[model samples]
Target: MKAKPSLRPEDAGDRPPFGRSWGVLYVGVLLNLALLVVLFSLFSKAFR
Candidate 1:
């Protein structure tokens, strides 16, 4: 009989797919959101 595979705490699935770390990804997302908000506010003010 074959033995079952085991799981480890050091698995790669726990890490970010591209960035250096999860914090970097979070920061990037937050920055992007802030930039979008600023641009939208500026557009609203200019159009009015």
Candidate 2:
């Protein structure tokens, strides 16, 4: 039987496939909150 090569920490590249960034995520969350607020306001106004 052949033995598999051992993996090392350095074998991985510096950057991950998905990567990581906070700026875009923050903007997306803020936009979602704004849309939710607008929707809720419209519904409340319509029912009242």
Candidate 3:
């Protein structure tokens, strides 16, 4: 039998942001988008 090659190297830090996990970062971004939508809607209604 022959030895198989490795996929990932030994040194690798898979951090998303703020030292948090990927899922946490994703949720934060979604929440930020939702808040922006709400704010824009309010601003448009107030001006129009």
Candidate 4:
């Protein structure tokens, strides 16, 4: 079997697939959760 090439952080090939920072993705997830929580609270209040 052939050996696979190792990826290094300093190498140009080692980059985010979305071409964006991981922090941006994490922030998006957090904002989405916040929006969902707010919507659910509104929905629960409407039913009560």
How do the predictions measure up, each by TM-score? 0.69, 0.56, 0.62, 0.62
**Which one is best on lDDT?**
1
- Indicate the residue-level lDDT of 45 in model 1: 100
Q: 1-48, model 2: which lDDT tens digit per residue?
A: 999897666554533334254566667789999999999999999999
Ranking by TM-score: 1, 3, 4, 2
By TM-score, who's the top model here? 1
Q: For model 1, how does the per-residue alpha-carbon lDDT over 1-48 read when each residue is reduced to its tens digit? A: 999687575564667768988899999999999999999999999999
In angstroms, the error of model 4 at 13 is 6.4
lDDT of 3 by residue, 1-48 (tens): 899775454224566437368788889889999999999999999999
Per-candidate Cα RMSD to the true structure, in Å, reads 5.0, 7.5, 3.5, 5.1
Candidate 3 off by > 4 Å: 1-13
Q: How far is candidate 4 from the true structure (C-alpha RMSD, Å)?
A: 5.1
Deviation in angstroms for 8 in model 3? Answer: 6.7
Off by more than 4 A, model 1: 1-13
Clashing pairs in 2: none
Superposing every Cα of model 1 onto the true structure, what RMSD results?
5.0
Ranking by lDDT: 1, 4, 3, 2
